[model samples]
Target: MNSRTPRPPHGSSRAGPPPRPGRRTFGAVCAAVGALVLAAPGCGVLSPGSNGQTSDDITVTSTMIREGEAIPARFTCKGEGVSPPLRWSGLPDETESLAIIVDDPESVGGAAVHWVLYGLDPENPELPEGTVPQNGKQGQNSKEQAAYDPPCPSGDTAHEFRFTVYALKADIALPDGAPLDQALGAVASNTLARGRLIATGGR
Candidate 1:
């Protein structure tokens, strides 16, 4: 997808002023920010602080693809490039909201964030194919677009895409179109538990 990538139905156009030229690549942005992104204060590079939460604490599943399997082309840049369906359970009883971030940390250009989404309803455990939950909010991806930029890894080797979910103590109050860094920081801070469902995709 080019710069004109269309927003998913759940995406918002209200993100702050469009990203400045040359600031399109997330890796560049992280480098420019020094240790901010690396420290989990800005970028979603590090998973939210678990505060004792463990990956085995929650169970994330998806009918579109199995754990560690290759993501189907239908949900990648090779095909429709739509968001895949996801389901999760085992949230803490105190969980009040949820967040999901899909990213490729091994991207040649640095860690490329394909999607930044938050404010999901804690009670809702499933997201249908190509869609976000009704209450979910969309945060700008590394390209500064608030949509799913389907993975299109270069070369023959597949790229690992982390579909991580965070169970938060409360719903985030970020505005629609918030930057990825801001949204991720909020999610990380409020996270009560977290889990991941890894999948791969490539040319």
Candidate 2:
């Protein structure tokens, strides 16, 4: 029962573009003067689509986690037993539903399922920390239980957990507690876009 606090979406922290040479400098100076007259606050210059609000702007991140790294037992099959927090931004305005799935890529056969959640509100970009929806549809994990079953690799080597987020156009039609394949089928049928984050944990 691994538990983890949800992390907030990280806003980009970057400096503005470098000042141009004389010709561009003169144009910039004029723009700055106009901003002063309008009493507009300074604005950050960013590359297009840097903010995760548009269809092409979303970004996903985990708390102190990276792709392919070993995940801590606290968030694995052997600890405090809470779902890890996940955060994302930049969904297309038309997104209606969201789904999340976490799995172990190094499981016994091909890959193993750990957690599956679907029908989340796209408007709510952050899932509450340590949440494992007891009543939500629990899919059949690798162990065949309708609950989160973290990776417990047999050997001493660490295992990687891949967390994925899907932006869908509609709620999946599957029933609660559906099997993993059924749930995934619904996602593939309706997904408009998706993103991923990875972390590792082992005994």
Q: How many times do residue backbones clash in model 1?
A: 0
lDDT (tens digit, per residue) of candidate 1 on 76-104 = 88898888888899888888778888888
> In candidate 1, how many Å is residue 152 off?
0.7
How high is each candidate's TM-score? 0.78, 0.64
Model 2 C-alpha lDDT versus the unseen true structure: 0.54
- Lowest summed lDDT across 10 adjacent residues in model 1 is found at 1-10
Q: How far is candidate 1 from the true structure (C-alpha RMSD, Å)?
A: 8.0
- Cα misplacement distance, residue 44 of candidate 1 (Å): 7.8
Which residue pairs show backbone clashes in model 1?
Answer: none
